[model samples]
Target: MPTLPHRLLHRLRLPALLLTAALSLPTAAAPATPAQRLADIATRAYDDQARFDPLSATGVGDHRFDDQLPLSHAPAERARRFAAWRGYLKELAGVPVAALSPADRLTRELLVRSLQDRLALAPFPEHLLPLEHMSAVPVQLAVWASGQGEQPLRTVAQHEAFLKRLAGLPAWCAQAQANLREGMRRGVVQSEPVVRALLPLLADLAQPDLARNPLAAAARALDTPPAGLPVADAARLAAAYRTEVAERSVPALQALHALLQGEYLAAAARRPGVGWGSLPQGAAWYRQLVRDQTTTALTPAQVHQLGLREVARIQAEITRVAPQLGFTGDPLRDGGLLAWTRTDPRFRPFKTEAEVLDAYRAIDARVTPQLPRLFGKRPTRPLDIRAEPEFTRATASDHYGLSEDDGRPAGVFWAVIPDPTAYSVVGMGALFLHEGQPGHHFHTALQLEMPLPEFRRRTWINAYGEGWALYAETLGHELGLYTDPVVYVGQLRAEISRAGRLVVDTGLHAQGWSRERAMAYWRDVTGAGAAQAANQIDRYLAWPGQALGYKVGALKIQELRRRAEQQLGAKFNLAAFHDQVLGEGSLPLAVLERRIDAWIATQRR
Candidate 1:
């Protein structure tokens, strides 16, 4: 629970020192220049980013900032942050890129450009609709209260800290109302279906049964009774749900529901696209987001086109294996492939969640020996598998979790197992490869172990991180993990899933496609059933451009690897190439390519 500045500076110190040292070393050639100074400033800029978003720090295993949260809602606070960003940009403009090392230069350019882009978005009324279907005040409260995710519920002090957090629910709901009101005035409202989803979620929170309520469950777990405190303390910690839900949260929901019903829903744009194009300056904002997220200057049209090409390539691969899985007739016609996979008995009945986890664990065991063949370095932290929590599992995907403060908990691959019958063994092996072993678990854990700056460790560029995982899916053959054709199909299906995302995500937001249209696209393209298709579309709607990052990133990484292999020919070392890709920490794809090209040149020597 450190202050924002403290948390931000703490994570930056190590990297700053290392970077300074690197720059000061007598080059035996010449003195440093303005560009080098700018690179140094950009590193500081990244430090500022780490501070502004502490949750991001936790994900990167920098626990120094775990207690702080951004208050982006306050106008004064927003102004202060904006001023700071403007100062950083001004400093960046003074230095040139040519004087810095390639790595530092890229960091400087990206940091400045991203900051400018973000400032451009500052005028938009995003704060009004900050809490949406993807994330909201209530959902975050549930996550923090559950004591299972990022918020540690371990010690007495930690427990009390949570109680204090819970006490602020009523005020948070009020803030949400104010924000939503602002959004309404500005015409930046959510779609009807998203607003409709909130009613049931809020009603569940407002339930009278304390046992079933997540807040009450946490309060009851405390060693001391929270009910017998001072009037003010007791009132604060006690169930504000009754008053908040009835007065604020529920009414806000109703207001939002009405807005959607009366205004936004009827006028809701039908294109099932994922971008800011629907709002004022949306096209420019989306272009900037594409640049920021991918860490490359690729346009939306370029990304959209890349998605098409990758989808075709992967579909051809899928066709190669579909027949071997005992499928007859065309795989893409008449729902044949979907029917076959969904009804296949080999894919059903796990009997228990443990069985599902064990299946992933077993894949972890099998994939260990192949690691040294493809990766010279491996993660010290172990990997585990578990079931995702039930409440959010409906919209959640299988995800990877980083280690705890002490690193004892180990990284985990959590499979969302709402019903065992829905589990498809056809894809489990590939899923394990991507989310569990040799994929996210290995990539993320090892990155945490690097000696990079704290800011670099905690920072994320979705394209490189997720793209590497998708590229890892392609490594199953190289790593000897896809011996089974069914599992091979699983890997293909996983790729298909990413490729399918490009079609549906853009279709929904950019193309004016309806929810049904998007869902049908996923079903037709990937052969995922109605339920799976619906969940995926809902996920995209909640998270807009996020889904596009996976396939987009994966394709870039795959492309880079192919380019390196083609150039290196017989001298190309797979293990060395992977080591180089990861050694630089999570970098923008452009930076990553430069690093790899350097490696390729050294090999040519």
Candidate 2:
């Protein structure tokens, strides 16, 4: 039986005490620092982009919109996206970099540069030339549905979602065709060779066989039930998937192929040049592409000169290695070291595909023992090597495809084995290093594992990533894998090829070099096989300025390492220097320099 006064006192006592404690504490919580605010902006920007670019979202392992596919190549839609980029750039510009922490400043610079590059090329007619080997929408969809790409097909929901995406193919291809039609009107179409190359690719997609049709293959491949799902449920889902794919996706692909072969191919034949310079506003467009890819102001001419210097330097190295291999043949003669070594039976050690794969595996195993000595951190995911799929084998470049950290799909290092019976094993070690351990696999997987912001984790600056891989190729020498003279020559030739890309890529697009001239120069300099020369030249035409990133990035990294070694002297730890370079995943070459400079300053202190 408590009185009113007693009850009131009990309730008020707690409230009164709490009020006194609050009053004694600080008046208001401190506002977020400028760096924190900028970080928030980055997070928001990534989320916004993920929503807009569903394909990118899937690639980053964000399954929020696994079923959605954007008609990004549609001219009006593309304009809208560009407008949003401008708005984002404006907001980013308002941020005060001077007030940010060093790390935050780097982040701000990266985002700013990324936006600026996108904005710089926004007005260009890239959409007109969208369907290239590097990023063909039709091929990409089939690849996605086939369960070989980033698209997930493990769950019943995922499989259904993929069907929806597959269904979107007709609309996407129609938009692409419309864009190409506009390009034809404007004389901004792709080269004849590039257009002709698409025929075989289209034929592969038009296969009637359900087991062979890439889209249908995705559904048929679902032979087992996903976890927790009954066998009947899985079977039902697969059957439904096959129906949509056969009836919908297959027809769409056939229609698109018809459009390409009948209309697009004829149009391309009427106008043919490997260079974008052949189009309206071509020179300016080429310059902008250079800026976008390299993130530097160096002109195509300057890049050409740099390439010449590197070619001579690497050629000299190759010549030095030639005499040691008992091949007295002139290294720079018409055939050179490349011709002799490639023809020599001793260099072609692998008689079978299994043996070739084993060599790469051995390279991985050999390099694994030495990784700790050069790198402080190693990616948890092991690199899985596989033969490139038949559909893409002709046009496919050897590359590294990253996997999710969840550990289901191991990162793949695709080795494009064209002639299995007589594949040359000259530079397999360096190639392995570039595409596998300590190169792409290390740079990409480590980035995924890092405690980085979402954008930083996923952002791929071409120069930084490619340069790191090229630099990784050099590490094979230090790791004792390049002990053989022939292997050393192989490494030198690979370096020369990268250097030659600088010369040849610019020659084709910027210097007004004809396709014939470019191919001739490639043969004269690197003595590359005719097939190799043609494949690479087509790649450059399809993807302008991309080839420049490798040499530019590698040279910058080599310079930084040289500077670090000089400044730190006895204090410079190779492992620590490598850790800093790869610690932040990929960076623009400029940001990388700033980061390395900061590390250098810290070491000096």
Candidate 3:
């Protein structure tokens, strides 16, 4: 449930433009071997990608572009980025893959597939339709500007660089307005609900009170000098910040607020329907979205059917545990025990936000001691739990935020409980397992600390990333953390929720299902509250094909684990298998299969 950075999208689509300087490196006299060629390409690609994506660069501890936010919404910029992708594809196509080692070959295959995914999206007008409820630019920049995100604000120079970058907000917002208008002209705007969700967030940003405004508060914090810094210098920087925010940031955000509330929302409201099928060439675009997100060719009908089967399977398991939790009834009648478990007051355990966080901390404590039994390795970065920022907590759910490679900040597990008393404890264990331990923190922290290719550490493929977390959800049983019957049911409920994703995601995007229908189906299958169901459906609308990754990736991992255990028999080590998966970092599900297969072969020998 970690929010994907907006710059990651930039990295995928605009990795080429940043490479203009990188591609100018001198050619070797003789053709290099495949290993050397791949190594060189990865190094160059990471450098160039960071150049195009300064925000991402800052996330990974690169400070070179700390003072810049490029005008990415301009048409000219998109054209340049598209051209760069083609040029890099051509360069990659020339590499002789037949001569490379297996590991190098895997990296080549992944790099090429990633480039193709980026190119596949270029023929469409998605660049114009950039803002979404899940990762809107206005919300993300506020987070960064508040010094709560990847942007560094430790040193005086860092703060000055941020101020310079902050000064560019007017131009950036102007470009966004222009692009949104273009998208409206092209009939490619986001859904109405997604656009409407932006209204309140932007309103909060445009608030006049500096104390209430997240961005202004970040600037105001500069009033206090850090460590040995002079008070006069800090005071001077603070004044400059307020001046820039008044003259630049506030007006830009106000303009953005007007555009969203007036033009964009009206246009999107007039659209025929929320699904991609309503737009021009939307059917083909949705198909491509499925392919890119899942990295598979399975049709919508196929994924939907698979979801039906998985949902039923997980429900049966939940029913089996129902009796143990003191819910006795006809085993399979009208959602049976699952529905009872959801509505029963016994399941609603938390009375306050502190209580919810304490439960999460307890879950983490219970899992930590058992972690070594399940894996050969663990992340060096310590994990901390915190409540989500109140401003965005309504839209945000429980998620894990990663730390920088330098380890200046430890990774955090964020729980957003809007109404603490109403918080359901049914899936708390599975959620913590997925978002906290051996899930995101486990996957991301190890990648940062590992001595792998920079690309591998930073790659943000959703299917592989989210899928691994979902897979980790199932590990609660193996790790001895799902001891209580209620906790085990929570795990089952979590799995069913993921299974619903495969169905509802494909149903909404590819099958022409309405938003209302998707919500209905989600409620029936998962027993989620109205707000929870509505929020998830809007997220799927905002990000087509993304929800499919969780189930697809988890199923693939589970399938591979079964295959490994069956093949190696007694020799199969769960810890080694897990290490093989996590140690390589995030991969496309296809690449993951190949890696696991290779490991299974080695174990057989």
Candidate 4:
């Protein structure tokens, strides 16, 4: 670790000493006013977060800890995070909420919820079951190393900073292996199939060939050191980085792969038996996950039933589009139309990848003008559609990568078009709405643009972010783009998919449904293909109750809009309501509801 810089050592030492003394005293005894105390508390919380997960810190534009990657699953570090959460809650308890402005109270509420959630989820074996096919530490480190992500690889210092992180990978992997073994002992393990799926991916990550090994991609980034760096230093840094990856990182990942494929794979649950409830205390754990994920008090059963009702409701809506699509059958009752749309020739309009890419751009252009009607605040940042990077496009799913605040690599929505002819036109509009404009791009960019507190800005509420995206899909109707029958049904299918997650996620975990049973229910409700259903089911298995948030959050936002519209009547401005919902950046659903209710009352005047 680098020593404290000589010039600021004394200055930093004084504040560190002062902070130590002040933290020991009663928080109420602090000299700052309540508002100042809250601000300090928020700042402290964010700093603690940055320190604990430095990669995330770098991802969010805080470079102070860019050089480090915490072995968070390690015992001492885990305990420290737990202690920090408890400590934050205790400090927050001292804040006099009544004395603060409504805004600060909301801040307090969000912070409290966020901290409490950490504590609530701390007891779960999520840390034990860390590695997944989608993402974990390995994928993250690879993404950062590729130089396409948030961490800068341009300057000599930046390159060295990442080198430090690369050096830490082996230790983190060792700890991760221990945790996985512990999970196997405690009956907290991933499915055999998921593990099997992940084995090859990890192998690819640890491959001997630099072209195939994702982690080694970091070395290529080091090939271009900042221009001013001395040639000797640059070459040295590049060699050190490649050596670190080849010597330390790849071997560590290989060890993990060997462990998982050998013993962990043997110990893993079979497909039908993979539900969380099969584990000890898993029922209650699933409930806690529900509470944590949805940010509401709804039980797993309630979510399941809500999913059922929504499936029926959306199925009814799907029937109305039958005439336009020429779909024949009682799809409204049993979803024949959904299956029909998939096979319908008209839906497969794209013959080339270029056509599919241009269609998305065209949709963005068409929807650009109508945005003013429903949103008072739109993102000032430019968002464009692009194919995923050539390296990962074949495997990566459709996703939106937020632009750096500096704007060197512009924000882009990456469309994963493995086969253009296979891309369905029916879902394109709603997909664009969710992943591109007025969804993630809008939600994320607006937060960066706003002058919110750093902690709040970076502290993404998954429910809010995803729910807002789901909610954003519906805005297509008001934006005048869903006039196409195919697009309208596409929107409904997307909603059904989210709704199906509610049932299937809760069913698999809480209702004791088998993987096959979950997939069956999912298809019956959403009319999704078998592959799609299996993929979605596996995802929920990887992260319980996480999928629950999409629909739950969107429902809450829609409910708040209804509440606001009912209260304000003809005076209600959708743009204003949307602004209120998004103006504070991402929020827990309950905190978001409070903000909306307050907005409703204020508008009553």
Q: Which candidate gets the maximum lDDT versus the true structure?
A: 3
Cα error, candidate 3, residue 432 (Å): 1.0
**lDDT scores in order:** 0.62, 0.74, 0.75, 0.75
- Flag regions of model 2 displaced more than 4 Å: 1-33, 223-229, 404-409
Worst 10 residues of 2 by lDDT: 12-21
Flag the better candidate by lDDT, 2 or 3: 3
Q: Write model 1 residue lDDT over 438-536, tens digit each, in one string.
A: 888777778768775444555555677678778888888976767788778778778878987777666666666777878777887778788878777
Off by over 4 Å in 1: 1-51, 64-70, 94-110, 220-276, 403-409
Best by TM-score: 3
Clashing pairs in 2: none
lDDT of 4 at 275: 77
Clash tally, candidates in order? 14, 0, 0, 1
Task: Say which prediction, candidate 1 or candidate 2, comes out ahead on TM-score.
Answer: 2
TM-score of each: 0.83, 0.91, 0.92, 0.90
> Tens-digit lDDT track for model 4 on 31-65?
47888888888887777666776655565566888
Q: Which stretches of candidate 4 lie over 4 Å from their true place?
A: 1-29, 221-237, 270-272, 330-335, 351-354, 389-397, 405-410
Candidate 1, residue 298: CA error in Å?
Answer: 3.3
